[model samples]
Target chain A: MMLFFKECRKILFSLTFLIYLVAVIGFYITQFSHDAEEKISQPMQGCEDYGTIAKEVPELLMPEAAEGLVTEYLSGYYTAYPIGFYKEVKLSEKKSAKIAEIITEITGISKRELDGFSDFDEEGITMIPDGNGGYTPVVKEATLPEINIPDTMTYERFRELMRKADKIIGGGSQYSDDNIVGNFSLVPKTYEDALAEYNDIFEKDKITGAYARLFCDYMGIIVSILPVFAAAALANADRKSRMEHLIYTRKISSVKLVLTRFSALAATLAVPVILLAFIASFSVAKLYPENNTDFLAIPKMSVGWLLPNIMFSTALGMALTEISSQLMAVFVQGALWFGSIMRDTELTGDIGRFTLVCRHNSLYDRNAFMENFNEFLFNRIFYTVLAFIIIALTIWIYSEKRKGGLNVIRKNIIGKSKA
Target chain B: MEKIEIKNVNKYYGKKHALKNITLTIDQGMFGLLGRNGAGKTTLMKTLAGLHQKKNGSITICGIPVENTTEIRSITGYLPQEFSMYPNMNVYEALDYLGTLSGMTRSERKKRIDILLKKVNLTEHQHKKVKALSGGMKRRLGIAQALLHDPKVLIVDEPTAGLDPEERIRFRNLLTDAAEERIVILSTHIVGDIEASCEDIAIMNDGKILWKGTVSELINNARGNVFTVNVPQKYLSQIRKNYIVTGMLIQGDYSTVRIVSDAVPDLQGINTDEPNCEDAYMYCLYQNGCEVQGGDE
Candidate 1:
């Protein structure tokens, strides 16, 4: 316990901890604070916009998905999220013919017409006169072609054809079963839908519950990756100070020393995030004074939602840094954070089992979060367990380092560098 | 207490053998290991501290085997050849942190830190940040940290390498005081430290011990082999090509060079001189044919 506090004090005085604090606070301020300044109001009977919701209805989805497939077929390339980053997938003429055949089977459009439309100037960025001498670039949104699915085609059959089209586009496309409904099944909200969502904030969320989701959404982005710097810096601190030998020769067992240091790092890095959680919950309470608010809503939610990200990144950072004696942790965690956040374009609630940064970017989407609550729980639990596993590996690595067991590895690395 | 017994210890860093079939017994007192850089003195020290594993050997420190690392570590402390604490921590804070790592209780840490700070003569600088300390002050703090737990053995590698003459003497005196009750192994390339502080010393070169005995025994062994010869400046280079010139005093066109040769030098005005630790070490290295080139430096 004393060593834990000492290690925490050491990290608290480090420049990396300061950088971590500034990053989380800066993210909360820039991304979430101003956007949520105005409190949510009751929905009136007749507003022009009530926002959009995704629902799986066969009639609406069939035409829309068919039109989307035809449009991408005409665009000469497909946009896919193969591993999370946006990928523009271009198919060979042979594979393009396969997709055209699937499009024909679903939309009753001929394959020759799809090939003929290739030279057509479809919607894209076009340069226009800005009234000055310079040209202004304007984005023209892509309009899905009007393609009608025959009445003889079943919705299940249409889905299978879409699956075939996704496989042709190299998977992770909107046509895949995992994403088809989320992508093409959206419908605008009705008056009752909007009003019910507004009341759910009061009855279900208790006002602060809704705001807590938004808080984690914004804080999760920076928290997932920023903690890597702290973990890596802490892991490298002893050697940087030329104190590795002095500390290694001590009477403390490697298990106790490694675990104490890890706990301290995890706690210190969590300080700013937990502080901001309190501030966010208090802010929501102040905003909705007449209603009840769970003051611990953000704090509780952050523990389940954001804490895994903090622990996972930090443990992996320490393990990688200890194993390689380099900042490989930063690159690996950064890639995970990036891929988890970019796995889907719809930001409100589309949690995957492996999403490191599970996001619910809106205040009123309590239902969306609740719908995927089980998967969210799994993701958090998986990361939490993974953090421990990696930390155990870190303890082993540290023990080996103490006993000069890593000299063979270090020598090989040095020998390779020299060669 | 049982002596630290190391029997036929061999270690390797990859294919290159670091400590080759080394065997020694170190008892309570100041024991000096004199060697040049890369002589595996640090390796031997680390192995004794349980910070390194020997390939195939047995080591028992104070009746506990080195394989029992936690027990060995509890009884032993190590200060590496190059070390400093977290630069931002004050002197007292630095010592306390190390004491904590040594598994001392809070009150125990406080008491030991106070005693060590006074012993190392750094009590006045207790509140100063480690970054603000001088090189010698940092070295003293290193010693303080190593001795924080009051271990049975303290292995300090090259403790006075970069200290000024005065600081070196003070550091050596501190080591001598530390050796009163426990074994303190001081490893260094500087032979003067061993001659001043150690009753027993070992000379190592290329991971092999060339000689191990008392300080005077080593000097006596090299007595007849050490000679000072007056040679012309033009012939100095030629003389160096034949012998290991340990020291030289240039005087106009002539120079008095201290050379270590197995036999009498075939030069004018050659006189046998008493061998100091440095001359004895050079003579030992030259007799063992271990490339003891000491000219023009």
Candidate 2:
């Protein structure tokens, strides 16, 4: 325990950790703090925009999903989020025909005619300002030739066809079962729908639950990447200072020493994030003086949603740095983080099972979050367990290094890339 | 008595044989390993300290086999050839951190650090940051850290390599005091360290032990082979090419040269001179049929 504290103190005083803190706090302020505002309002009649809500309406989803599939199939490439990053997959001829078959099954449009339709309009959702001084999403329609679903086709068969299309694109497309509703099922909300959502924010969320999700959404991005810096710096400090032989010769077991050092790195890196959660909770409490607020909401949310990311990233840094070198660890983690951030198209709760940063950027969509809670739960727990597994591997590597057993690693092909 | 024993210990760095078929007995006192830079002295020390593995031979440090690294590390203290502490840590803090890793209790660490700091002559500078320490002071601190655990054996590799004469003398005296109870293994290419302190000395060359005996035995072995010859200055280069010249003093047109040879050189004013540790080491290497690159410089 004393050794852990000493290491924590050393890391807390290091320049890298200071940069980590700044990045975390800076992200909180820029991405989340500025977004702390009055979001819910009673919908008024005759407003230009009431809002948009994702509904699993077969009439609305079948046409849109079929259109998206045919257009991409014609283009001979598909966009996917297979692992939380955008991927452009050019499928084989057999797979392309499979997608065309799914499209023909849904729209009664033959693959030959789908190919003959030279161009299709691009469609997306636009956020427009309503009269209540808040933005509401309005979907834009494509002007391709009209396509209709058969009356005999059931929603289940349509869903099955969508699933086949997702499979054709290699999964994680908007047509996949896990993401279809969040992607192609958005419909404009009626006044009553807006009022119901507004009431859900107060009655169900109790105000802070909604903000907590938003806080985690913004805080999660930086924590997933920043903790790597601290972990790498701490893991490499002994060698950088030429203290490895001194520590290696000690009576302390390698497991104890390496585990204690990781504990310290994880602890120090977590302190500021948890504190920011608390501060965010308190500040959100001030936003709704009349309503009851869950003061523990952000802190609890941070522990569950953000801590796995921090631990996983930190463990990766330690294990990779121990296995190879500090610079490589940072480079690998940076590339992963960058990839994860680059293709995160859906921010209002499309949490995938393998999403590195689970995002819920809205302050009012309690239903969207609860709908995918199972996957979100799996993502967090997997990373938490994986973090420990990596640390265990790190301990083994460190013990071997201390005993001169990792000569192959030290002589790796990276040319002086080993510690 | 607690001692280190080696039985034909061998080590290799990949295909290159480092410590080959080595054998020796080191007891509780100051023992010196005298060799050139690549004589595998560091390899032997590291192997004994559980930092390297022996291929086919056996080594036991006070009955603890070298393979049992945890046990060996607990009882052995090693100071590598190049080392430093976290630069920002004060000397006291650095010692405290190391003592904690040594499994010393809090009170034990506090008390042990005070004694070790003063013993290393860093008492007044205990509060000073490690980066601010001079090279000699850092070497002293290195010894202090190695002794912080109070292990049964201490292995120091080239502890005096980059120190001034004064610091080297102080460090040698410190090691002598440390050797009063436990076995101290000092590995260095500098023969003066062995000459000043060790009684049991071994000379290694090319992964082989050339000679092993008391200081006087080594010097006595080379007594008749050391010759002092008066030669003209112009003949100095020829003598150097023909024989291993250990020392030289120049006169007006003549030079008094000291050379180690198998028999009398064909020169006038030839006399056998008493061999010091340096001359004896060169002569030992020469007698063992190893190349001796010796000169006045």
User: Model 1 scores what on Cα lDDT?
Assistant: 0.86
Q: What DockQ does each prediction reach against the true complex?
A: 0.81, 0.78
- Clashing pairs counted in every model: 0, 0
The per-prediction CA RMSD against the true structure, in angstroms, equals: 3.7, 6.0
lDDT of 2 by residue, A277-359 (tens): 88887888887788888789888888898889989999999988887777888898898888878774767777888888888
Q: List the residue pairs that clash in candidate 2.
A: none
Q: Tens digit of lDDT per residue, candidate 1, span B178-215?
A: 99999999999998899999998888888888889999
Query: Candidate 1 at residue B128, lDDT?
Result: 100
Candidate 2 chain A — worst ten consecutive residues by lDDT sum? A410-419
Query: For residues A1-419, could you state the per-residue lDDT of candidate 1 as single tens digits?
Result: 98899899999989888888777888888988875576988889889988888789999999888887787777777878664456789999999999989988887778876666654455678899988888998887754455778899999999999888898899878898867887888888888988888898888788888888888888888888988888999888888899998888888898999899889988888888888889888777888789888899899998888889899989988988887654567878887777777664768887766677878888876666776788788889999999999999999989999999986786676467556
TM-score to true structure, per model: 0.90, 0.93
